[model samples]
Target: MVTTAAQIGWAESAALIFRPRVGELLTNTVLLVAITVPLCAVIGVGGAWLVERTSLAGAGAWGAVLAMPLAIPAFVNSYAWVSAVPSLAGLGSGVLLATLSYFPLVYLPVRAALARLDPALEQAAASLGRGPVRVFFGTVLPQLRLALLGGALLVGLHLLSEYGAFALIRFDTFTTAIMDQYRSTFNGSAGSMLSGVLMLLCFALLLLESRARGRARYARIGSGTAAPPRRIRLRGWQLPAQVGLLALGIAALGVPAVVIGGWLAYGGGTVWMAPDLVPTLLQTLGLALGGGLVTVIAAFPLSWLAVRHPGPFSRLLERTNYITSSMPGIVLALALVTVSLFFVPALYQTTALLLLAYALLFLPRALVPLQAGIAQAPQSLEEAAQALGRRPLRAFFGVTLRLVAPATAAALAMVFLAVAGELTATLLLSPIGVQTLATRFWSLSSEIDFAGAAPYATLLILLSAPMTYLLFRQSTVLSRADASAGPAPATSAPTTAETA
Candidate 1:
């Protein structure tokens, strides 16, 4: 942060603040966020309600379908849309693409909150002559305040950092502007100035979200083991409800599938069998696995300290880690470059350095689940194992580790998928000759070789499919745990880190 701040002089900052170009970028960014965030919230909250609270058929299947969009990177979705409809390449298209791709961030957490809500409150409201809508607004929405705000914060932060989708749509924001500035004029002050403004925007978002989240507790008290929520019978609206869900599924997941399928069918004879395809796929997988393992291992100690030994110092350490996660990938990559150049020249541009960058950027994804899991695991269980003559480490493995295994696995998969889909950081940090799927696709697409890029995009989606499924499945487990144990403390959801 100090380095970034130092890069901007008062004159440069003033110029950025007054420049028409900067104003245009700011307007475009605010417009995108204003349009996208609410759409995500409505779709996410409504979808969660329909799937989790209503007597909708195939609720489980619908849940999976709704959450599947997280597997499709926003850039891939933008490519799909732009390839099919060249005219759809601007602010409107950017907003639509991002909303479709990122609503799942809101959906997952809101759905989990809905799953864990004590249905008794809603039931009470309904018995007092309230309609369903009234009951929801009056009784249920208040409980969702924290989840909704947190999800919206994630979406907002992502918009601030997003580059790929916006860039493909020909829409420019601070992120894209920063990338362009850097590309055209290496380490330019204009880029740093834009980054300073972006950082301020992020800090404002963090402050607003924290204030909105408030200190109110959503946990249920005096619970006699709340019964499963009674699903609201849709009755006359059942068929329409099903159709709506089906449409959402198709809209979010279908467009990309069809676009990629068309590309494969048209170009497969030559490009499908390319030799580099296999190597790139393997390289992406290796990086993702290595990065995921290293990140999780690095996060364990911090998460443990936060959970088991809560204090101001531990909390500060955790918060300090997240500050980097909120920064754009390019900014973080540049910071790494600067530090490595001066102090660790041998590590510069090495795979180890690249993996370290991934670990730094994605540690929160690993830490959130780990902290939650550790918090939920009973101290008594570990004590019991220790009483049985086991060592501390052995007791942890036998008891706490077993208990948190689902969340641990979820963290690993989340980080793995994140690393696989990452773009900007990988672009800057990868070794001289290394080409991951994301970079390869970006390269081909930039050359307007949509057909050639199709295969990499397809494989990226295929690789993400299983991890996405694992996320949804583990979400179910977490939801169940939350429901039975009462509302867990709020933690930050994952944020996207990119720049156009």
Candidate 2:
């Protein structure tokens, strides 16, 4: 982004930044984030609390339903809303679409955190004469700091960088403005200027998340099994809880299903038989799988370095990846376009280049889970393997890697889902004549051919659904295992892997 901006003279850059359009976009983006992120956090945290910590009816079913929004991309959600209500266009619509789509980003993680919280802490607080609300506010909420902070950070970044959802609603954000500017401006100077401002916003988010995270450690240090959290009895609140959850589910998940199904029925078999459908689906899956694999491979070493070799340098490198991933996809796409065109002409507009962009854009998605998973894999286990005549490399792959398999799978699923629904980057970097599900959906939807877009949108949702389930399942299972599993016996006894 800086390099791109440097191409223009200072006066041109100033003219770009000082314009009225930039201010409007800046205000819209800031207001969108301010409105959507808090709503998402509230819905996410509250829904997670009700389902996981309270005796909400059908808690298990509710868990899945709360996470269902994640299966629908924000753009698809926006498409559904626009179809349902033709007048839905503006900041209000943007906030509604974004909150519904992104609250799950908060809900899933917070729910998983709630599932793994130690009941003993709450019990202790209650025993000290704290009321239920007091116990929750003082004990449980504090324990959830990391999950809440991470979820909010993700929500904020998504709101900042999201393109299609806002674009569909005629709501201008930095991303949408950047795309427009790139298309019209000479050498993309104006677009690059907008991207620079957007990057600064991303950096601000990163810095805020860092400060909120502080230097506090949330890990349990002792060697004892944690008791499962006891569900709080809702009592008089059960009906209200059920009502709130039902409304949320209907808003977030029901809208898309109904709209898409209506469109499918309207279009009938002919739409399904579109010549591009199969090829587009295949290409979407192929890219998603390839990008997921590449991103996971790229994240593994960084995760390992962060987990096994903790230092200021490692932390800086970790933050650097987050900063990269937080930028609007258009920024990364344009940067890659510039680099490939000037330095590696052969790589221009190729699958490899696109995959590289994906890796760069979604590395943090892959890195976060890998770091958590690797951190949980005891270093002693690998050392024990080394003692058993295995090489260090072999020990890590054979011992530590196996332990973090679930997390690795979760990471892969995350990146896969992200790549499957990616819009701006894919639109720019995908090879000529290549159309993934996202690009196809955007094209048809933009042309007001909702019926033709429905299939693509449906396919995108289907592609993400199982991955969403996997993410929810893996997070809960891993967090519970970490909470319940006692530390290795401090004896000469070999571990299970060693014994096996």
Candidate 3:
């Protein structure tokens, strides 16, 4: 069902978070990115090198540690810092908080890229008399360029839609300003105007990422040819590496860890075991799982139609999917709200509505990965399976589906993370008093009761740990067995990263 926003253009009204009067909001946003993006890129590269390429002790443990901050949501980190100092919501502190919250975007990709690189190149570079630092700068950095930009793109897109943290700290950005304008002034036009500008900014960042990442292949595909990437000698830098690693980890993870720990120590120990918490957990997880399954299922038809039909309408639909995905969660949720209440009243405030919102907000993520996976699976294999006494569905399942499952799983993980971290949609469209971990955390933190919110924050992080793992664990082996045994000879096309 197309929403009211689609019909009447509510987005323009909500988008005015970028209105000229709110020039400070635009300035704050640019300043936040200018500081945070570079900081994260540096941290990501340095942390990846320290954990994956250095002779640092317990690199495996360190690798997990570096990625663990991803489990900590930006809002939780912001909450902890503000709670600890009560004055860190200042502009500088917000930038620091945002940087720590997002560095994992760079770290996971760089780490995975480093893990997949052939050690021989660096070894050869060394043999040619280039020092390790020079070899890394020349060889490693180029290969990492796509993964790094990809990660930065994720953070940039996320920041464009960020609200809870910024809202909590009394900072205003396009996302927060739009919501405030809507709730307080009920000025849909102003909100839409701001949203329009934010949309432009999102596309701008995406375009930047696309250009930066053009046509770069990061992974070597063959199984037997793959070698563990070389480790550099961090002989004297061990102490520096350790100190830097500890400092970053402590600031990022330690604040949240200590806050949650103190909550558990105090009267809030039972908050972890609250009566409603389990049900809320089940509700949240159920929504994520069902949303993932349905989004992937839905994406196939959309992807297949484009892949097979190859027309202007198909291309338009494909791009429209991305447009929906790129919209801020709140904007999407409000769109759904207005549409459903007026048109599909039966669906209002229900699980189906919530899942539909998730699909609309995140469908493009599932679509792109599935499209790449399906493209790699090839049309020929499905045809061959059909020639061998199978139906179209069977051929797709046995041949195409099997080949595409890895990328599908990856797509699922990414959407799962997006849904789990989502705040604005849950805030608006969730049934009366529906207490998601995110909602509960926001509710408590809004009351200035950090202790009450800590458990939910911790639980939310734990719930998302698997996703954090998958972000870097893409280095794990592809599902090679299915492709190996297909009824037809499975011809492989290039992977997404391969075609870049």
Candidate 4:
């Protein structure tokens, strides 16, 4: 870690920043993040408010439907758009793809927070003669600040690291540029130097995301029970609200459907087939399954330590894991590649290295939900089992682990989906001649072959749907389950991962 950080501060990093391509890359990266964050927040917060404070029928259904986009990888989403419309093919395409794929970052937390928000505060705001907007922006929004910020932080950070989708859209962001440097000039000192600069940019984003931590996280997601918020009848505007939602959902979801449909029709084959499909499919599945399992396994110790130990060291370790996960995957792939060539030469070009990179990059997505699961297990129950002569491990498994089982499935689904859709690290570090759905789509799109890319692109989105469903379901389960429980007792709230 020390050496990696130092490399970013080295003179080579200065040269990296001054290069013209580097500037364009950095600008595009910033634009992607800047554009996506607010868009995600709007979608999440709007949906949350609708479900929690409006009279929309079947709101629970809407919540699930709205979050469905999380299933579609941005690259898949981008292809659907560009392939279908061909006209929406530039900056606007990048923004749309990013927003559609990532809005759930905001949706998950804000939904949880809204479900648990205290109705009295908003009632009090309106009782004081504030308009609905005023009440929401003032009293309600302040209380939801952490959730909103945290969700936006995730969206922003994810955007910074995004690769597959942006590349397909013909955009050049930092992750794209870094991949180019590697593929075009793998051993060139210039490529490594550019990667070093990317690491710096990723580090800065990590720092900015950290600022949203204590300043935001007012309550744990999917945990705690507060009274259902009173409805804010959109008395005069109900029709408009429904119309707007329909339009938004259509725009977000429809283009991809049409594009994939047309391509499937025109090709006279399985929407799923490519001549190289089977090998790539097996490789993609193998890596996604392996990485998901590995990440979950790695997170177990950290989650246990953080939830059970309750110490500064454990806390620091957990935070470090998140920080590392927040760093762009491109940076991680580069860091691992750099390590392989210099320190672990035998591992280069091997499957083991690629899996390790996946584990490092998506570790937090695995950790957060798993930690929430562990936390939902009451500490007292574990203590009681331990006191009855059960071994600690036995007690945890016999008691807490059984309850947290659903969460494990959810975590695995999320990590697996993320790994499946990932493009940058896989592009940079996979064995030569390797192909996954991601690289398959990437190669075709790179050659401006949108028609050829369509099948892989379509499948990636279809593949993501199940994972996204599981994520929303698990998040909802955690929220509804815990909403009855309220916050962990203040004294026990700091439980470390070790104790469980």
lDDT of 2 by residue, 1-500 (tens): 56655777787789989999989988998999889888988999999898878888999899889887888988999999999999988889899999999998888878877877767778989999998899989999987777887888889988888999989899999998878776666366777788889888988887787777666655555664476677889999999999988998988988899999999999999999999999999998899999999999999999999889989998888877766777789989888887888789999989999999999999988987898899999999999999999999999889999999999998998898899899999988899999999999999999999999999998898888897887688777877786677444334322111111
Candidate scoring better on TM-score of 1 and 4: 1
Task: Identify the superior model by TM-score, candidate 3 or candidate 4.
Answer: 4
Question: How many residue pairs clash in all the candidates, one count each?
Answer: 2, 0, 18, 20
* Candidate 3 wrongly placed segments (more than 4 Å): 1-20, 214-230, 268-275, 303-320, 338-351, 368-417, 476-500
lDDT of 3 by residue, 294-354 (tens): 7887888888777767899988888777766766787777667666866799888887888
Query: Is 2 or 3 the stronger prediction by TM-score?
Result: 2
Cα lDDT tens digits, model 1, 377-440, are 9999999889999999999988988998987887888899899999988987799889999999
- Between prediction 1 and prediction 2, which has the larger lDDT? 2
Question: For residues 1-500, could you state the per-residue lDDT of candidate 4 as single tens digits?
Answer: 34643656657556655878887777777777787778888988998888768998777878887888776677777777776666765566788788887787787878877766656667778889999899988878887766777677777777777777777667887777767777776744555566666667666755665554443334444443367667878877788778777776776677677776777677667535666878888889998999999999998888888787869997898877766777787777777887898799999988899999988888888888888899888999999999999999999889998988988988898899888888888887889878899888878877877667777877788898776786688668877766666766333222211111
Positional deviation of residue 335's Cα in model 2 after best superposition, in angstroms? 1.6
Ten contiguous residues minimizing lDDT sum, candidate 4? 491-500
| Model 4 TM-score, 2 decimals | 0.86
- Which candidate number would show the highest TM-score if scored against the true structure? 1
Best first by TM-score, ranked: 1, 2, 4, 3
Misplaced by over 4 Å in model 4 are 1-13, 87-90, 212-227, 270-273, 373-406, 448-451, 481-500
For each candidate in the order shown, give its overall lDDT on alpha carbons.
0.84, 0.86, 0.75, 0.76
What are the runs in model 2 whose C-alpha is more than 4 Å off? 185-187, 217-225, 300-315, 368-413, 486-500
Runs with alpha carbons beyond 4 Å of true place in candidate 1:
4-8, 341-346, 373-410, 481-500
